[model samples]
Target: MVEFTDIGDVPSAEVDRMRAVYQPLADSVRELVDATIRTEMDADTVAAVRAEIDAATARLRSRQIDGAFGVRYTTGGDSLAWGNPVIGVRNPIAPPLTIERDLEDARGRVFTDFHLGAAYEGPPGHVHGGVAALILDHVLGEVAAHADTPRFTGTITLRYLRTTRLGRLHAEAAITRTDGIKAYAVGHLADEDGVTVEAEGVFIQPRWARG
Candidate 1:
């Protein structure tokens, strides 16, 4: 699905306003998801809350865009992909990673510091391997993509060293090299203790961009 709408060159102030409006909503929804899992409320109360939630969902659906909110960029180069699954400000499913670029490095290095709570668990008390892949894939892809040669993942390989605890974690990636239309990158996901998952991937720029 895709969001087919034009959000013209919105100014930075307007972008901040948009974030103010939607990020909070996503925060509340994210909290609700967490609460829904841990809540020990009475059955009656749970049913009542479910009813209210249903009503709220209906109200929101009453007036909405047609498809997924796709990435939009400003003339200044700022981007808003608020519905993205990993970092979308408007998506509760996201850990909502906060990625930072290392300007001093020449590899287009990027890192994210994020936390995963009860909602992202796979094993008894650990985060899912797939979740780690999802984060690393996006991070690696970000580094592999160049301004002149936007790319897509061609292959990704991951190594699970140990179980990732569901808590604060750090991850980063940097492009190692590029060959014509392809870029290669490496990254890892880690907890306070040490690295838990490492990844390497190749991202290829589409042929259309070669011209």
Candidate 2:
């Protein structure tokens, strides 16, 4: 297994340099996803492109270490979760979330900025409802996990107030209340105009976690 370390222990300078190098690669992958979804190539050309992509994927895969990229920290105290589904550096499926967290407040607040592409479409030019729910679940879970109180989702409820447009979008989440082992959180997804979806969730610290 590949041993993991948190980025927290890494030198700030090294972390900055690594981010500068890897971020552009991540952005390029993101653009590739967009291009793949929007391309209008003919069948034979598409097949050729797919074969080339497969070759590239195979090459990268061969160079990668085995297993998932678990969270890791360097000896210098910098932590990195480079494979995180929402903001992973190497995960091509993620929407490249730039999540911001407010750590000072008792009820933690989390926000993310991202753009949805054709792969996320539902009704015509709008984003899929399930995709919105997935984003809310992640943000709400983060609110529950903020400040080291990591909790697992016990229940979630989502209300689709409107069709979310497939473009730049904002999401926000905050812990609403907590009672004993359970934490309640509220979250929303919005476009430039206003809120499109709202969510409420309950999270529980597993029994082993309390010990």
Candidate 3:
């Protein structure tokens, strides 16, 4: 479902300032995730690092929200989806796809080029099938939302052709057809070899929009 909170009172300047301050921390946390997976330090060093991590975690928890981060909008009509798992700039777990709106022959297309590092591996050197599904769902949802009225994912099907390797990858989704309040779209995940997974999804207008 689409959610955008109004931060009309908070100066846009402060919003940008907070984002600039925290985004790099998220980037470092992502690097920390990769390092945690590959580190080969001595037991003492690991313990020392863990202590520092614990202290940092405690400090961060001292002033934190009790719920998931919600989408916020700026006065200039910009949305900040900073907590979204697929593309949240503030989320350390995101492959962080920056989907773009491109039209081919006058059809709306949403595409993103991203990378999956060590933290996302499920099968040795390949990306997890579930992760691929997650990417497609979000990508397809973007396409579904770009039409006259926004939509939410109703159902999605994915077909795995070959293993998706962990490296630079591409994904795109485009609406093929629509019926009433429904939209159908197709997309895929690809490596240099070609499409590794194919996806199609059914999206429907929210109940509020349906009426």
Clashes of each: 0, 17, 0
**Candidate 3 local lDDT, 1-211, one digit each (tens):** 5555777767777878998998998999999999999999999999999999999999999999867888887676667889999999999999788988885545588899999999999899999999999999999999888534778889999999999999999999998999988999999999989999999999988887665
> How large is the C-alpha RMSD of every model relative to the true structure?
1.8, 2.9, 1.9
Ranking by lDDT: 1, 3, 2
Off by over 4 Å in 1: 1-6
User: TM-score of every model?
Assistant: 0.94, 0.86, 0.93
lDDT of each: 0.90, 0.83, 0.89
Residues 1-211, model 1: lDDT tens digits: 2332456777889889989998999999999999999999999999999999999999999999866678777766667878988999999999999889999999889999999999999998899888989999999988898565678899999999999999999999998998988899999999999999999999998776678
Tens-digit per-residue lDDT, 1-211, candidate 2? 2345444555779888987887677778878888898999899999998999899878877877677778777776666777776777756667867789877876789899898888789999999898898889989998887434558889999999999999999999999989988899999999988999999999998776675
Candidate 3 differs from the real structure by a C-alpha RMSD in angstroms, to one decimal, of 1.9
**Candidate number with the higher TM-score (1 or 2):** 1
Residue pairs in clash, model 3: none
